[model samples]
Target: MTAAIRLATARVGDLAAVMRVMDAAFEPAYGEAWSGAQLLTLFALPSARVCLAWDGEQVCGFSAARIAGPESELLLLAVDPRFRGRGIGALLMKDWQAWAAGEGADDYFLEMRADNDAVHLYEQSGFSECGRRPAYYRGNDGMVRDAITMRRSRDRDGED
Candidate 1:
């Protein structure tokens, strides 16, 4: 029988596999991929956590985030190209918010390039743009892209 796909909390031991997922998910021409060292350092931080969706030994997707005080920020979310449009990214987003909410986070935020196709997914997940950074991201082709900051409110009073 084949092992079923499942989501799990990522650990240091999973770094290599996680990086493979990241590399496969991102388009290298965009220069948005994070190196293994960067991911290792981020995961090693006290406030950061990663959630991985795995199919047996293969990493299908992952979401990394940081929680500080009453707020939490999604640092990165990626799913292998072969897994796109299969609801993997949405599951990761929901998991990130749910995990942070359980930890007393009242506001969840994420920053992404304005042209990202995932913006619709984020909006569908209850996020709204709260800020913007002009020309914040530069691609390998020398073009700059705007960055948008989105927030999801977990409190009834709309306060973070």
Candidate 2:
């Protein structure tokens, strides 16, 4: 039997699950250096929108966004290590896009470390590189790193 895939809203109680997925998907080299407390702050942000993918009791993947004015910025996306290759990331992204569209967002954006392989994922989701911030990220290597900014806009006909 195939495992059921479910999407649900994330709650204050789900911070630990979200952190678990993030820590597993992003090692010290990739994550934002955010402690658990910092992540909790994200849960508290007024503009925050978070969603999680579940396979029964396990959290398979998650995504978050923060909307400001006309732009919705994807803040985090991670799939559990055990469930990485089954299109869970894409599922989470689709959910996020739906939420942003419901919020009347006209544009969506995200920033990733220049070396992050997930840039390809964003591209596959229709985001295009619009700008870059050099030396924008502080790496574990004790050097600054660049970040690539990507964007996707809603068509005037209201399509992504």
Candidate 3:
């Protein structure tokens, strides 16, 4: 199943498909999903990049990031629930890091709800916990969750 998945640069026409994947991937209680308009705003940024993963004709995953000088932030990443565990998330992370590096980014950052299991995937991709905000995310159910910030520095001749 993983073999059939392909990653490509996201096009404006792919917005709807990306939204569908976002809807399926994010649990409503977490209030983590971004609106289509918000995503479109990212598309207008010169430094922003969005990648989409497709399985046949279906959009299964996506990742969005933006770079500023030597720093880059991963704004969003999601894989459809039906496509989880097939390495799509890892693929997205790898692609984002490469894209950022190519765009002159040396430090990469991402923040997520502390309880998110995707932390494991980010860690595997070389991101480590760098900071945290207590009770940062207020969920739809009025429950708060910590937001953890993770960072990965490109190894420049063994120096981070």
On residues 1-160, what C-alpha lDDT tens digit does candidate 1 reach at each position?
1136678899999998889898898887679888888889876788888999876767899999999999999999999997777788888888888888878899899999999998999999989999999999999978899999999889686432
Give one digit per residue, the lDDT tens place, for model 2 in 69-154: 77899988888778877888888787888788888788999989988888878989999999999989887767788999999998
Off by over 4 Å in 2: 1-3, 31-33
Error in Å for residue 69 of model 3: 1.0
Backbone clashes in candidate 1 total 0
Which residues of candidate 3, in runs, are more than 4 Å off? Answer: 158-160
lDDT of each: 0.87, 0.83, 0.92
Candidate 1: TM-score? 0.91
Best by TM-score: 3
Clashing residue pairs in candidate 2 are: none
Question: Residue 128 error for model 2, in Å?
Answer: 0.5
Tell me the lDDT of candidate 2. 0.83
Best first by lDDT, ranked: 3, 1, 2
Query: Best-fitting candidate, measured by lDDT?
Result: 3
- Which model is ahead, 1 or 3, in terms of TM-score? 3
**Per-prediction TM-score, please?**
0.91, 0.91, 0.95
